[model samples]
Target: MKNANLFVDEAEIEVHSGTGGNGVVRFRREKFVSSGGPNGGDGGRGGDVILVADTNIGTLLDFKSARTIKAPSGAHGGSSNRKGASGEHIEIRVPIGTLVFEVGDTADVVELEESTAIVDLVEDGQRVVVARGGEGGLGNARFKTSTRQAPDFAKPGKPGQSRQLRLSLKLMADVGLVGFPNAGKSTLLRRISAARPRVANYPFTTLVPSLGVVERDDRRIVVADIPGLIEGASDGAGLGHQFLRHVERTRVLIHLLDLEAMIVEGRDLLADYDAIRRELGRYRPELLTRREIVVLSKGDLIHDESVVADLEASLAAREITVRRISAAASLGLDTLLLETFDAVYDARQEEEKRASEEARHHERVGRPGKI
Candidate 1:
């Protein structure tokens, strides 16, 4: 509960678009002529409900208390061929990586059913219309013909669309830092980026995921420090289920290990690593396949370099090379950042290549063939 603000990722709200304005029936009046023709104008269209993605906002905290969002209705048409004013659109700002789901059966008396995926707002300034406004009805003047002398009736405007929407936010980052509690992940994040996450010596100091932007060689890499994981994390132990989902979108993971804790607390380094891996595999098998960089933190606590070398050698046997770094002393940090950035850049290139190949394959498969 320390970082409660970061966990407000889900919200459900109802949105209603503006109704169209009604057209009025009027006749043009002249100063000299006794008879005048119909001059009534058409009504204006209604407003739309739109969702905008904003990078500044990190969570859906704003929508937690908001139950319903309504747009302003269009103004009614006036006499003498004066058109009605269009309704103002209602815009809602959400996090950049928000996923919008359209809820079905939103009646007050009935229970809501499963929601359908509408759209994913991933980039800044991206927007999507959730509900459309009702159309305006035609005026009586439009129905008037040469045979008809005067029309007295006018059409009303149609109602706007209304529906319930669910907004779910998933943090998007190039690197994700994962570890047990008090593994110096928060300290490392603060040392590398401008993010000021609350760091303490106790366990579970970071209850929520914290994001920071690291700049290297004129390039920016966003890193997310997820909360610690314990045994049985996949089964919701120690609120691990809430934190693990944030790591799914990361391109690379920095698996931090506490060298000091291994010695002081008498914890085995390999066991700690495997336990976290098991949880990740159980929660999502794909997470196990992600590229991970093992990091042994708190090098300042250990005086002898052999201790660090021994641990590195042990992990190397399992095909995992460990990077030794001390956040307090700022030792080996520059190398760690450079290596992490390189991994992220390489992963991005591979992803783009795969996507291009898939697109070409689809195009070839969908092309016309001779009979």
Candidate 2:
């Protein structure tokens, strides 16, 4: 039997807004009135199609089964100058970083910059109406004038049109943890943070990325656990390029090491680390150069700290600063958090500094230049 692939990385969908209600025409009559003026009721406005950012949603798979979205139509005009009922608004639930694009050749569409990872959708409810309903027509009463008494003509309600939009979800996180399968990456995350990612004694227990919030005093950080990568992950091997792209927005990376797995499998832990680096280089070279914290996990498995100490010595010999931690016993967890937070904060400050300098340079040159 073949393995069932349940991953949905990308999807396309269409959204539309509600239409406006139309106006109606009517006449007021009485026993003594010779020619009563036109009194037409206006039509109700059409429902609006709204899109909201939801942090709880992790995937666009919900939109996979439903391809098209629509809003309610405006109610027709009523008699005695009574306006028609407006259409109801339709709210769409989308992942926070979902980007929308107009589907057409040379179509100029709007782009929303996802600068903040933790979007407060509850407070503001960032909403955008994809399509707007047409305006309601004017009633005959609205057209009444001294010269146009008892006008027989009344305006008709306009119809709402449809548009094609493309939605794409981009995973947002403060830090991303990357490594090979069964490298104690999940164990480290579960130990340091409150994220309860599925942990097991086997490989590939995490098929999807998970996130956790780490808080220390008044400071809080979001840590992401990206799925494991294999030898040819860049070219689509073992859950491939799909999961790698999720780490693109992370501020830092934590690479976990399993000392025992390396010694028993006849594999060099450093070499395994290098293999992952090579894959990162192949898939995204920038990822290889990002701020990373190297850690040797399951340190308590060995009899003495010398086993980890020897690995650290070897890494230091290669100019790599390694941090060792035993996730099971919660050893070195606090130090790991302190170092990671400081590193991530420093990296962010440096990035901000560069951005400010670039902006200043652009101001001086009166045009944007390459950074």
Candidate 3:
């Protein structure tokens, strides 16, 4: 949990619960008692393998080494009709927002697109039993009858269950950071939240998405640092589809454009914005209609401040409001936070309203008098 890998998003794991303890077959032969009745003890129940949604774990990397998770077996029964001790249940901790699917008997790899999720771990401290332990066996004493003076046989414990599971993490975020390579999205994320995503001058510094929680007043807003997108990314070029999958659940998009590129590389600011928009549309058209705030990042690199205003006005002409900020300079970040929080709040209200409406429409159409 301490050194959470910021990269791992999916994994395949196997889980096996413990087998129950065996029952004992013995007869009372103590203190001068002849032909004592059978007194074998029953076995204890086996342990269960539980799955817990832990916020401390950041990714699925925790399961990398623990492919086969197991629980302890119950203790064996003793003589004199003494019951065995039950095994302790074992818990496997995973990050929140993880989706679990049951894999086939012989499948080595998990294909999530073809399978339905068995559980969606969204809340911290949520738990589910992945593998149930075997039942305890009965002792010979339990099998004794009036006709039979004594029973010699004891029942054996049943074997535990084994199954393969697929884990997929879908980032649950209020805001998604999106841009081309080297657009300073990572830098902005660190500037805004405590998430330590890789930041560099090179392209694709953030190979995988990482989450950051931004606390404002009494509310918390989760922001996702989605990996950079490029042209033709929507069609699975350059791990586009993988990156786009994480973006589907975001309510707002913070589209960053590098002002440094505009000044040094003579890159078209409008073109950079358009390229990302096209990729989002191709991946999912709904993503194009999400609430977006365009920000011209790395404003500290530009000597003439008017150039930032000019770029802002250029986008404003197309009815797009923009924010100019430099993460290093700590400029305009507070305003951006306020705006993003407002957008998230509005979207949350709309979501609750729609859910309430659907709740009142649970009745089936053309059944009875319901419409």
Candidate 4:
């Protein structure tokens, strides 16, 4: 069996709406009546293809195998003035924050020159109609008029719509975790929330991003542990490049550092930090300006407090504060959580303020004579 919870962020599929049913031409033949009028019934309408956002679903893995989606066709009309039943609509459930885009003609073409923005599903239970069903045909009875006493012809049903679409899933979280491989990101996530991601003592252990919800004092905050990054990650060197977009919407970022790895590999802590920073800058310049907290993982392995103090001093010299925590030892986790909550709260406040200011500016600009 496949992993049901496997993380899949991107998918491409073909969607087709159901076609309308055909109308029937019939006439009533009674014993007493010489010329019975046309009594044919109208056909039923086709079904539509709808996309619904669901918070329970986390990935697009289900759509990977099922590439084509088709709705049921409508029923044909009956002979004795009986209308056919309409086809049932097909609703596909997807994860929240899923972006749907219309695909171009070519199969391999990922980006289209002129693409239509179908829908951006950001809220749970939100739905969008991707394809419209065909219209039903008119029966022969509808064609009877004063000029034409008995009409035998019936109108054909319109064809349904079909199109190819691309779905991209971006994780929605309040905080994002960023670091190199084996930086204890997975461990930290496990310590903070109930999400138990695959944890091992190796590099690239976490191949996919995992989300965890942290609740404190009736306040809930979602955190995403993004895959580890290496040099040239911005240039698509590792798995981090594939998941970098998931972190773009986070309000805060936690930069986890593996102090034990730096010590074992005889690497400078500042250099490692700078390398990650460079990758973030290369990928997106704005990511560098996002509010971030630096953390040193595996504090239990480091016996010398002076080493941590020196590293903290170096980071402080650059106007960056550092925090240390050991997930295995369950140390400093409470303080980390509290501090993270504070940072998240501040970031949210700032974002709300900026949005309010922008709304006011737009209102002022649109008023009266100000073009």
Candidate ordering by TM-score (highest first)? 1, 4, 3, 2
* Per-residue accuracy of model 2 over 257-306 as CA lDDT, tens digit each: 77768666756788878988888888778988888888877777778665
Give the Å shift of residue 363 in candidate 2.
8.3
What are the per-residue Cα lDDT tens digits for candidate 1 across 290-367? 999988899889887776666667788988888789999999999999999999999999999999998899798885
Better-scoring candidate (TM-score), 1 or 2: 1
Residue pair clashes in candidate 1: none
**Candidate 4 Cα deviation (angstroms), residue 301:** 2.7
List where candidate 4 sits over 4 angstroms from the true fold.
Answer: 1-5, 106-116, 350-371
lDDT of each: 0.84, 0.75, 0.84, 0.85
Q: Candidate 1 — which residues are off by over 4 angstroms?
A: 1-7, 31-35, 105-116, 306-310, 366-371
Separately for all candidates shown, the number of backbone clashes (residues 3 or more apart, or on different chains) is 0, 20, 0, 0
Q: Per-candidate TM vs. native?
A: 0.91, 0.84, 0.86, 0.90
Give me the overall lDDT of model 3.
Answer: 0.84
- In lDDT terms, how accurate is model 1? 0.84
Model 3: worst 10 consecutive residues (lDDT sum): 362-371
- Higher-TM-score candidate among 2 and 3? 3
lDDT leader: 4
**Candidates ranked, most accurate by lDDT first:** 4, 3, 1, 2
